[model samples]
Target chain A: MTKFEIRGLRADVLIGAEERQEILKGVDLTINSGETHAIMGPNGSGKSTLAYAIAGHPKYEITDGEVLLDGENVLEMSVDERARAGLFLAMQYPVEVPGVSMSNFLRSAVTAVRGEAPKLRAFSKELQQAMGGLSIDPAFAARGVNEGFSGGEKKRHEILQLELLKPKVAILDETDSGLDVDALKVVSEGINRARATGEVGVMLITHYTRILQYVRPDRVHVFAHGQVAESGGPELADVLESEGYERFVKAGASQ
Target chain B: MASPNLGITEHSHGAGEIPISKLDTHGSFDVNDFPVPNGREEEWRFTPLRRLRGLHDGRDIADGVVKVDVQAPAEVSVETVARDDARLGTSFLPTDRVSALAYQAFTEATVVTVPADTTAAEPVFVRITGVRQGDAYGHVLVHVRRHAAATVVLEYSGTAVYADNVEFVVDDGARLDVVSLQDWERDAVQVSHQYTRVGRDARFRSFVVTLGGDLVRLSPKVGYTGPGGDAELHGLYFTGAGQHHEHRSLIDHNVSNTRSRVEYKGALSGEDAHAVWIGDVIIGEGTQGTDSYEHNRNLVLTDGTRVDSVPNLEIFTGEVEGAGHASASGRLDDIHLFYLQSRGIPADEARRLVIRGFFADLINRIEVPELRERIMAEVEEKLALHE
Candidate 1:
């Protein structure tokens, strides 16, 4: 089992050349392996900021915080180091990388993360199997990574990476936003398959409770004003679904 | 400025409002017809005149012979003829100062011919080595006769200041594939003009790869003599520190139902590394059903490097099928770098992968397998120098 903790995570984003705006303020969270946590928040609630800050995105400056992955200082590691340490961030908007085919990118990623390059025959079989599970076209293996992919196709590719890389802790940021009903089911199934291995922790961040219906979360945290307003079991998600985030926004304003 | 010299008559067509640029009417075979460029003309604006080693001016006249060695299949014919040979300049004329100077200075010319109704089983390799004894002038003519097919590779190496004009004459129903490689020594300077004439229903494909040299300028021009002719020009250049490599291509659609496509990609690294690509496509009046497009893309790998990419499209006829041009030069996309690094690839390896991918689309189009591999290896070597 692996324990990941973020304590007093205060961060700022550079809005201009010399301007900095504080986004995450004194946010705290802990996630353990094999447990899925649903971080529910409205717009500008610092959900994506928290995800990027933990993933070592250069855009976010961690002013005051400590992120510990199994008691190791995760903040000191570089972006690739964070990735090599078994942390993956499924970006809300994955950028298109032209000319680098999906097969080449996946092989490089797997080799870097796993410390050794997999045999070509074995890796091809594994990729074909994973892509089949997600219903992705086999031809995508030769096409440039995420180049000219539709909204739904891009989201599915993100999940495909998640299934192939097999990180210990995955922060899926808005993976189900642009997906259709059928794509959502396929993606959720892939997430569940990763979770079934009992070696990965899922931090599913979303504004809607629709995806929670498919992949049940062990914990639900209502994130507001860069802090957790309330925390509870799976029932909390249903409560938020019915009541909406109006109460949490008002409570955060008052605080 | 010169009244649209090729095909369009001024004020005679409805599309006569477009201004005629001086470059459209510049052509001559006499060295004295063209003035010495002071680096201000449109053709000489991006070039470094001082680095030319007098190839641009008359100081570097041809005094030493640049050895020309031709290797071809037994069926192909190779001949060395005097400057007065009738077939030397039958299909080409000097268009610029350097070309005119080289045309007036060379003592002999090398002509490689593929006879009519025959297909050469192997590519003809013309390897030119600079003697470095004195400035050199050279000329080569590649003739693909009627109903024939051939492939030619022109390889340049060694050190000296050299200027040459190469002509390609493709007859009716013939096809010619040519790859001109400028892999010179570190201190070499070369100015080359390659003019091609395609006959009725003929096809021409040319690849110009510039990888080494202190200063190298190449102008490749193509004109169709009859309808249904097609031409494709593809080029790749990697400019290292203090190196200047430029490619200018002009495609003149003088007849109807002709087609042309030009694509050039470049990468520059190190301080003072400069690359320039100029693509000019003109669809003349009455040349209906003309299809042409040119594109240029440059990848800047380091700071202090410069790239100038200019694409010009001039169409005097509104009846053409299509005509377009595009140019772009910039550093590698940071998001692409981040995307790769976020996947656990190291920063250096990520850069290598992105650069490799940037050139893969063009390199894969090269039909020669060995040359393609060598170009990739050379690209990797340049990337390593940057790192």
Candidate 2:
């Protein structure tokens, strides 16, 4: 099992030569391969920043932190180098690349991570299978990456990348936000399938326990005030879902 | 009262409200008729006058600087004839001064003729190269006979101060595709005008791809001889540091039942890299049932680069089928870069992918794989300079 560790991570948004606001104060977490950890939080809780800082996002300035994947420094790696180091981030809002098609984008990413371009025959077959697995339209292969795509389609596309890139540790940031019932099921099944391989670690971030009903997390983390306020098992999700995060927020505020 | 535009395809024309009336472009082809521009004229406003290299003033006409070579199939005939051969200026007169000077100064004109009803089995290729030559005037004429379908490519390269005139005539029922690539060396200065006439029920299409040159200013005009003519003009260009590339297009729809589409996409990087695109469509009297749409888009890759795009439409009567024009320019999308980098692709390669994707749609229309790959490789080379 590959061990992924975040020790005393802190970062800020480096927007256009100005690092004005800090997001992650100090975050600490660890996940091994074949494990699923869920990072749940309310809006403005800095959950997204945690994901971005760990992935070496340029916009995020990591003031004090260390993101280690199997004892390797991810913060010291470039964005693509971080990915090649077995770290993946499925962003809540996937950007639209106007000219590049989904097939080309996926192939490029696969080549970058694998250090070699995938064979045409194998790539084509694998792409088609992944599209089928994600319940994505076959026509999307030629369409521009996330261009003019609906919210649900974008979420499904993120999962499709997860199924293809096959990173050792995957950080899914709010993957369940905009998906409809059918799309949520399709996307959740995609996540579960990736985990079933037993070689990948899953970190699913969300606000509600809705997607948790489908892809159960082995560990549940309640995030507040830029760090984990509480951590427990799947039962913790039920408690947060039924009773709400009012107590957790108050408890975090008291600290 | 009802809306004039009820068709779903109306949206394809884009949304923006410019005057439905005409804006006259101030200059004519006659050497004496066009007054000397002091950077105040409508056409010369955006162009840097100092960079024109005296081609605008008829000061330099060094003819033998660039070598012209042609490789074509046997079914077609290539000839070098004088100005009064009765074949010159059959389609239209020059619309600008530099082109007129090129017409007046050139002693010999290269004419490639395709016989009527003969579909070409191979493309005609014209290669122009200059070895740091001083200055020159050039002219090219393409005559496609009735019902014939032919493709021609004019490849320009090397160094020179050049002005050129290229004319195309598509006879009745004939189809013509002309691709002009201005892949000049970094110090080349070129000004060119392309005039085309599409005959009854004929089709005309041209791809003007500009990849190099210090300053390249080209204007292409299209006119129809009869009804049912179709014209598609697609162009792509890239501007680097200290380079100025300007392209202007005019499609004339004076007859009934004709269609015209113009689309141009460009990118600019480096400090002071500039690009300009002007699209003008005039639906004159008797032009009923005319469908025309033109769009210009620019991607600014760096901080100091600038792009100016103007899309104009002049509709005479409401009897027209549909007409519209639109233009937009902006910087490289940040979200796009982040998305690609997050997926393990390096930032530099991701940027290239984004740019390559931008031109893939139009480049795919080239039909020939080798040519498409060749042009795209040059584009890749330009991106390497940045990332």
Candidate 3:
């Protein structure tokens, strides 16, 4: 089984001209294969910071942290190397790539990850099946990636990547934000399918517990003030959903 | 225009509100008749006169050697006749001193002619290889007769101080495509003029690809002998350090119900890389139904590179179709690069993909698949140098 460990992860937002703001202040987390860990937090709680830090975003500088994938220091690896090492991040806001068709981009990504280009017919069939499962139009295979796509379409694209890349560890940040009830179910079902593979460890970052009804998490963590303030099982999510984060906010404030 | 009215009486109207000037673009082909350029004339302002290898200042050198090879289908005819051949100057006269001098110096002219009412399934090929550094004058003529269709490819290579004139006379109902590829050696200098005359209902398409030479300037002019003619000019170029590539085109809407479109894309990298493109369209008096649009976009891939783009349209009649022009030059899109890199693509590969995609739209328009693949491969090779 795969293991992803984030220890004492203190990171900061990189501002212009050597300026930085500490965002994730000494956060710690651990996720293992075949498990879903949902990160629920308020705005400005640095939940996304932890996800970006683990994914090695250029804007998020890990001031004091070590992210390990199977004991390999991910902080020392290049972005692509980290990906090749089985780490994936479903960005809250995916960047648009013009003139690159979806098929070409996914094929290239598959080639890079697999170290060999897949056979054309098999890859095409796989892509068509995956896209069909997501209810994506077949015509999107030829369109520019994320160009002119709606917010929900962009989110669906992210889940599609998560399914195709099949990383050992996936950090999904706010993937359910823009999705409607139907899309949320579709996306959560996709996540469940990946988990069914028993090879993916999911770190699902969300503000609401709605998606939990579709794909239940093994553990739930309440993040506030740059760290997790409370942890429990699916029952904790029930309490948080009915009661809300005011208690956690007050508790974080007192500290 | 988005579309032209084919049946409209376009030849009876005059040019629109552009001012009348005495500077006409047509004249005799006599060497002494053209004035020596002092960099003050409109035509000579952008050109570096001293770098033209004395072809402009009445200094004609014949020491340089140039070999020309022509390959054509069996039905076509090819001849190297004296410069005084009746068909030599039918399409155009020398409008500039360099063209006049080249016209005066070339002892023989190579002519490739297609018969009337026939089509060549195979493309005619011309390869011009310059062997010496001294100045040389050259002339080429291609005539496609009535109802005939032909595609001509002209490729240049090696080193020389070369000045040449190419004339195209397309007859009524004919269709022609000419692809001029300048894959020259690094030290080559080429200054040439192309004059093309289209007949009634004839169609002409031209593509100019420039990838080499220290300094290269080309002028391709288009005019119609009768109505219902169409012309398209698609150009692509890449300039490296200290290289200069320039193209100036004049499309004279001299007949009615005529259409023209011009699109050129270029990339410049390295220090002192410079490129220039000028598109001039004139809708003269008594010509109506003029449909035209021109677009030029340049990708400035590195620092210290410069580009100049100018589009001039003079219309003497308003009773015509649409006309438009656009120009843009900048570095490759940064968001595209970051997006690709975010997907784990290396920065170099991302840049190459972006460059390839930038030129893909135009390259896809080539009807010949082999030529399209060849050009795309060449573009990839050029990108490797930058890497």
Candidate 4:
């Protein structure tokens, strides 16, 4: 059964401004439970916007489409409601909130998503275990969320949240953008751990296949001009890796 | 300066009546007793002097007796002290100083003293209420005696279009945790002067939260009297529509080896809601090994909101270890708001969280649990007003 389904999705960018343009037009995709799907795209391909739209960002108006999480229309829900509906987005640039401790933010987010307060002792033990598994310093739990953290540290924090919240559908948006080799490995391993739950569906959005080598997506789709241009097995990542989306660009132009 | 009508009315001074003539007085000074030299007056620049034009005109004191509610711990008693008492000192300008004489003349002045070397288990709450017409001048003399540590919360809540002055003296080795809440009626214009003296090795932590009144000015002046004295002044002010909130703080390190830190954060919303933060730190000539820092930050919540921050550091002797100041005035960062909203928190909730987080450092510094909770409630109410 489909865990998330998007039908006839159409999104526009800067509708009233000079850069007014249609980014996602008539796109259709579906992800089943316990499956990892990667979306590879060139620059300006609306990969990030799609992730934001699915996460119900207020700026990204759903002009014409229906995003159903577990067959429930997500467009009708608020951003936080969508989050409570088990939808998680690993941001490209995680915002830094000074004076808001990491533990507090995570606790609030986790309780919000779970719709109930987590037992303190159990939550603390679980959080400590998760931090250790991700190789994150325990001291970071007390520090402000993403404040002055390195790029890798931020990505790891996002994964840590995902593991703790246990969202049904996790959208990884450019999680590998600024990570070093070691960071990429750690982040990919964290994702793998989250995937090991075998109940949550993963939508991995990236431009590079380096991270895919570790997480190993079940399916890979090439996104161009706001729509998925091609789809295949994991080998599709290697083809794009060698050729660098030149063929996809030409094909997108013809279409 | 003494007003002819300066006497205890129906309100009791705890003790019997004391005439104003008995008080130590400062002789007549110029109309501008405190000079604000052209641009050199950092605290005077942002104030709208035009609004203060007729402030000196003597107005009639409110006719009826004003009832002030005092909420204190069971052991700590509170009663109005005589305005002419010498223990309060000559720090505050007498009620007869200009337009506010009438209000200051009638209201009873309250003094809350924590005895020497005695520690109060709970915070003492002093709520001053001004009703009816005329100016109101009430002086609060807090003598946290030697080695005595206590928390006092002074809240100005009333309906009076007048001025109020509060003075506090923290004695040697005494620690005073003061939280002032200003929530007056819309028709009221409040001009409050707060003076604090930190004795040798004494510690004074003050948190001022301003959220009401059409125009409110809070000038908190702190002086380190002896060596090793320290003070921390943290303030949070929120200005809604058609409101003007001004906060000025001065940290005077008179003795050597003293330290002072002042951080004031303000958020202005609505049309023509103006807020100002002026922080000045002066390290005296022989104040060697002194460390002084001041920071003023303002967050404009709307396009029509205006904020002015002036952080001044005057160091005479360069023998100090560190002396610096910082000021920032900016709008609510969209990126920061969006980040919080993305985490399933609604836009309004996110804004409240961000603003609350801005003052969290100062709030956490408050040692009094009851005062902290009350301040948090006030902050929540202020944020809800924006919605």
Candidate 5:
């Protein structure tokens, strides 16, 4: 079954009072359950914007397009409503909340999304298992969320949330940045574990093809100038890796 | 001035009542005799002296009984004492220290004591109410003896046109947990001071919530008198339209091996609502092995709101294991708020939950359950008023 569908997705960025320029111009994409798709793009190509717009961020205005989650209209819904409907966005730069402990934050978020209080014993057990899978210290649960954490720790924490919440569509936006080899391996492993549920669909947004080695993409698409310029099989990622985004930009300019 | 009713008094022996004109020339510590200096004065630097000048207007003393509501546990004792009580003695000062002495001359004070080596099973509640339009003064002195442990809730409410002072002390080896609630009327002006001394192996914890009053100033000072002493200070302040709340804290470590931690959080909204937090930690010489940490975090909810945070640490000895301080003032993080809202929580509810969660760590640190619940309820009321 199709997990998420984007039809004629058009988004714009308002720089100043009167400057309304297009960022994601009439893009279209689709992802099915149990499938992983990679959107490779250069800088300023609306990769993060696409993730944010799909997550219902207030700052991003969807001028024209329709986003559907299992055939349900998502643009009309609020940020949290879309989240409850199983859309999750792993932020590129997660915020640091000083006094809010990770455990308390996750508990409140999970409860709110589930519309019920999570059982204590079951929740703790699941949390412990997820933390172990991500190689995160159990003590991290007691600390504030994303406060003074390293880049690797933040990415791992994002995956920790994904593992625990088990959302249907997980949007990973540049999760591979600033990670060492070992940290990247652990993070990709965590993503694979999250996808092991079989019902979860993954959208991996990245600039480098290194992460693709661990979590192989079923389909790869080249994104330039705010829209997908080319869609092909996994071999396309390897070709882009060798030639870099210059060829794709030239192709986009010619089109 | 001559005494009118003294008949056949053989030569006045007492310090003759100075003439009202002479009283204006530095007779003791009179607020009128001393000039309200500019911000150049060290003590007056951070104080809102410009706003304080309004007290000079002919605002009469607040009259009527001030009602106090206590929500503490049953085992905790409560009592109201008269001004002449021997236990209170001359420790209670009625003078404004800045204005008229007669304004608070008729005030009654309350004293709460937890005896030595005794641990109360539940937290105690003590509320003081002020009513009418005349002056009112109150002195609260608390004594916690060695090996004693108790949580005390001191709540102040009412509408008064005068100033108030609160003083307390925690003795050696005693554990004192105090939660002070300041929810006065809009027209009221309050100046409250709380002082605590922690002795050898003793612990002192204080949680203050400021959510009311047109102008309020709370100064809390904690002194570590002996080695192995510890103190924990947590405060939360919420100010709405036209309200000004200021919190000043001083932690003094005089002995070695002492430890202290302070965390103060504030939220300000509405036009011209201002909040300030000033934290000072003084680690004296010979206070080696001392560990101290101070942090102040403020959240501004509206465009016109303002918050100023100053966290200062003066360490005299380099032998201390650790000493650090941090201060931050900004609006709520958009991503965290959006993350919460994306999960089906409305924008308002999301903001409220983030705030509630912000204080959850500090609230959970309270050992007494009853006091924790009361603090939570007070926070709820403050958030409700935000709507």
Candidate 6:
């Protein structure tokens, strides 16, 4: 029974060194455990910014906002603090950290969130089981963290983290992009596994409706002009998929 | 492609690249050949000459004293021979002023020999401790006979200003592994040159770890005697505040069917910490099927620290398997930090993990389990100081 809320979130991002561009303007959303919310938008509509802003990325400066998890201020938390506070972001482009083995990174992350390191035997068994569930090769545990991972492999690794970290709120940013049908199915299944736990509030960001076919969303929101322009039940996704975001863009620009 | 590369088609016999390559390096046994460096020469520009404690010049060289202790398996032989012994300089000659000065100053040299066709059951440990009264010089030779295999560990410690030359002669079909640990005291300064000649079908691997010193500089050079020789050079260095560490290596592929690989990693912290790595690989003419690659990486932990990494590759023969060089030096990547922190690792712990991973690759290859753990513990201790 976890509740996450974002009210009037406005954020600006630094373009180079001095120039700042406002990407998110008055974004409002709420997600509860056992519910999946699909964030749909056109290119440059600030969908990714919303995800990063909520995850506490330094690039996204929150000018005016209130993000709370269980009534605890999330926007005030540091990036790691936000994570330890049960917020996770599956980045669109997960960084490749050379020389860091996957086993070590996952263990460190789990220890930080859990406030204590799990027993070695139990942890290894748990890790092998989770990786097996995703059809990932056990050999990858010894390899550098995403050092030479393919696009789909990187996506699968992100889902693997979600399955292990078990955060209260998870934001999957473009997890379906660059994924083939087979990989998309595998990733969708991983998300569904986390969803079945009834403890994770999922915010799925995407530009397509393909992933929604596998993991149905409870609510759909159309984002445009750095804010939500339309919100409706799951049926709204069908209309938007057929009619496209042209009308929402026009309406947002007119506003 | 931007370099003036002499492809095999340009001169099939490798005539165009032979003379120019030979003229680039000037090795001498005479000290006068290399004048006193004024901190302006290409080789001395990055080094703090004044902090060298006169190891670079002839001043109070005999006032210091160094004691040597050797522990070896029963199969190996260790002896102190006069400088005039025939096998003293058979492998290579002095290439710098400090090396030549050490050659002219040392009275006796330690020679460790592994008998032909015998594999030593235990490694040979050469422990060198010195006093910082003035200056000292030393020389050591390790010879692996035909079909023999051996491992040698040279441990340097105590406080002293020292210059020395170390040579390794690997016979045909022999295998040699050497680990040179420079763990001197805070006020110690040392300049050491290591030269190796790999015979036909011989294998040579050397690891240089520099962790403690005021100013430490080491140069390791390898040359092939015949074809089918292989060499691997691995190094790790940690520079703390007010300390300087430099490593220079050269691999000479003069024969055909030769292979060489060099990898060096360093981490620097605190103010005035400096690190320098120079890798030089030369593929000479008439050497076909030569495979070589060298890379240097540095991680700067604190502000006001500096790192200079340079990789030089010269290929005269184009009909080779592969040849490449890479060098990088910078602060810890922000993206790397972000990636770790995004996973819930605290900022300080994330930094420590990244630095540990940076050196783990080289440290894991140390072969000795105890030594590997000790190195990691020492690195962690250093990380704790500034954290």
TM-score winner: 6
Evaluated with DockQ, which candidate comes out highest? 6
DockQ rank, highest first? Answer: 6, 1, 2, 5, 4, 3
Alpha-carbon deviation at B69 in model 4, angstroms: 4.9
Candidate No. with top lDDT: 6
What TM-score does prediction 3 earn? 0.69
The residue-by-residue lDDT of candidate 2 on B122-230, one tens digit each, is 8899887877567887788999999999999999999888888888999899999988899999998889988888899999999999999999999998888889999
For candidate 2 chain B, which ten residues in a row score worst on lDDT? Answer: B1-10
**Candidate 2 chain A: worst 10 consecutive residues by lDDT?**
A14-23
Return whichever of 1 and 2 wins on lDDT. Answer: 1
Docking class of 3: acceptable
TM agreement with the true structure for every prediction: 0.81, 0.73, 0.69, 0.67, 0.68, 0.84
* Cα displacement (Å) at residue B78, model 3: 2.3
Model 1 DockQ, alpha carbons vs. true complex: 0.49
Off by over 4 Å in 3: A1-105, A114-163, A167-255, B1-24, B226-228, B283-289, B315-321, B359-382
TM-scores of chain A across candidates: 0.98, 0.96, 0.97, 0.95, 0.96, 0.98
Local accuracy of candidate 1 as per-residue lDDT tens digits, A135-225: 9999998888898898888888888889888898999999989888999999999999999999998999999999999999999998999
The alpha-carbon deviation from the true structure for residue A43 of candidate 6, after best TM-score superposition, in angstroms, is 6.4
**CA lDDT of each prediction against the hidden true structure:** 0.88, 0.85, 0.84, 0.76, 0.75, 0.88
B26: Cα error in model 2, Å: 6.3
Q: Which 10 consecutive positions of candidate 4 chain B have the poorest summed lDDT?
A: B18-27
Report the C-alpha displacement of residue A253, candidate 2, in angstroms.
Answer: 14
lDDT (Cα, tens digit) per residue for candidate 6, span B144-215: 999999999999999778889999999999999998999888888899999998989999999899998899
Candidate 4 docking classification:
acceptable
Error of 4 at A32 (Å): 9.8
Chain A TM-score of prediction number 3: 0.97
Docking tier of model 2: it is acceptable
